[model samples]
Target: MTSKSERLKDEGSRLQVTAAGATAGLISRFVIAPLDVVKIRLQLQTHPLSDPLTHRDLHGGPIYKGTLPTIRHILRSEGLTGLWKGNVPAELLYVCHNAIQFASYRQATVFLHSTLGEGTIPPSAESFIAGAVAGGTATAATYPLDLLRTRFAAQGNDRVYANLREAVLRIGREEGFQGYFRGLGPGLAQIIPFMGVFFAVYETLRPHLTHLELPFSTGGALAGTIASVTAKSATFPLDLVRKRIQVQGPTRNQYVHKNIPEYRGTMSTARAIVQNEGFRGLYRGLTVSLIKAAPASAVTMWTYERALRFYISLGERSVL
Candidate 1:
């Protein structure tokens, strides 16, 4: 039904979208990587970060405290490289995830607008569904890398599985294939709605904020902050659960978790945290997450849009 030129144009558009997503992920990953390391350590910790006494792991290892102190401890102990632990896997995970997410979202949007929602459903609802599908697809496709990243970040100086290659092989041999998907259920449950709200809020706010002409994209920053914080606040507990679950493999003893409960499922994990550590346990590293993710979200979306515009403009210039 479409001309050759139209088909080519569509392909180019998809490529541009994916490229933009990849660029955004690559750039933003470097921006908040250390903070992400901090988040994971906090998430995997079983005790209150507010405790005055340094909590000890089951192995009597020093459990990390609040963000700054934790950062200091890591630097004092593991050197600067500690902040970027798991960075390789984290980088790959983000690039692949953003590319898939944006590409799938574009396809889903087109499909819904032209086919499913044609003359029927509202655009807002379509955005919600499309965003959900996009996040879920990206998460499922790149889950192994994510699991690896979490595992690497959750550890301190006492490394487990050495590097990425060893981590993959040992996890495969020891825990089996299911080890790769250990936290996938909670991850998906969190990401699906998390991204749904994310895109919905972003789409709603971007137009208004981008046009405000505020210096350094204050509006865009505001929108991104609001979106990330709002969405994360709701799904953050599952994120913690996933981190806990991922480390429950054979190498579980490698890290310090202070007798962390073996969470059977998402709900059980939530219940265990509530019973043991109180409601606040669900939000251990939340401060750093909000600080890191909020700005990273803003930068990512802004960069993605800028990349998209740059690519599209180049395409147009070539055409002209």
Candidate 2:
């Protein structure tokens, strides 16, 4: 019989959680990468698909009007490999991001329980703060990979830098070190609250999820879908802005899209999107994003939970 303590982990030390998270991220990044590429292509397109004038724009059309259409366009235009456009840098980013985020989250949770408990802040509030800290730290640490991934996925027939190494070296040599972090401000803006609510919602639902007695995989999937949809929806605009900013600066000329705008900052980027494309522009790729987010998060959490269980069981045996 599974003991009460075994139903959910007490969370584990920072190192164990980190390893599990890295494993989870590596697996999920591969699974959801095609959807991720489709989403980025849709998000980075400045022209509104709703506009009939979209036909005039270089990369615009009904090409980006929906998720399936965008995928088809990429496949037709850029081939099968296009779907996995940025997988190289993306792998590094996802692995490091999850490792650091989960480790920090575990540490933050412990810190909260020791210092504050449920006395001052609520448990959900503690989760929110911990998630924000974890997301911000991970996003910042692995941001260059993120920027590189975005650039790689954002390109079409025209190439920017031949490979990951060329892109990194060119950005460093040409745009300087700051080039690696072009959109970091908005990235943190998007992630902090996105993850804050992601954890808050997951932790909030977890007790209830346990009560349902679903199998581990099914329950994790349900929880991940709910948390991911809610959080991704709330902060998606900033995500759009971040991708747009990353493609700007010294190398703008090489893109297939001729008229991409350069914005001053986050608000500026957002304002331009809204003013030109209207409110719907802020959520350009939301459908595909939610689609990608669900499986990615579900796989990540399911894998992490299983790994945590294994680690805990191993520890127990070692003690015996």
| CA lDDT scores, all candidates in order | 0.84, 0.84
Alpha-carbon deviation at 139 in model 2, angstroms = 0.8
Deviating ranges (above 4 Å) for candidate 1:
1-12, 48-52, 55-58, 256-258, 317-320
Q: Estimate each model's TM-score.
A: 0.91, 0.91
> Which pairs clash (backbone N, Cα, C closer than 3 Å) in model 1?
none
lDDT of 1 by residue, 1-320 (tens): 77423543454498899999999999999889999999988888776444566744445556776789989988998899989998999999999999999999888877776675453665567768889999999999999999999888877677886889999999999989998999899999999999998888887877787667666666776787788898898889888888888889667767745456677788888898988888999988989999997768978988887888898888889999
Query: Model 1, residue 147: what's the lDDT?
Result: 95
lDDT comparing candidate 1 with the true structure: 0.84
Q: Give me the runs in candidate 2 sitting further than 4 Å from their true place.
A: 1-10, 53-63, 211-217, 315-320
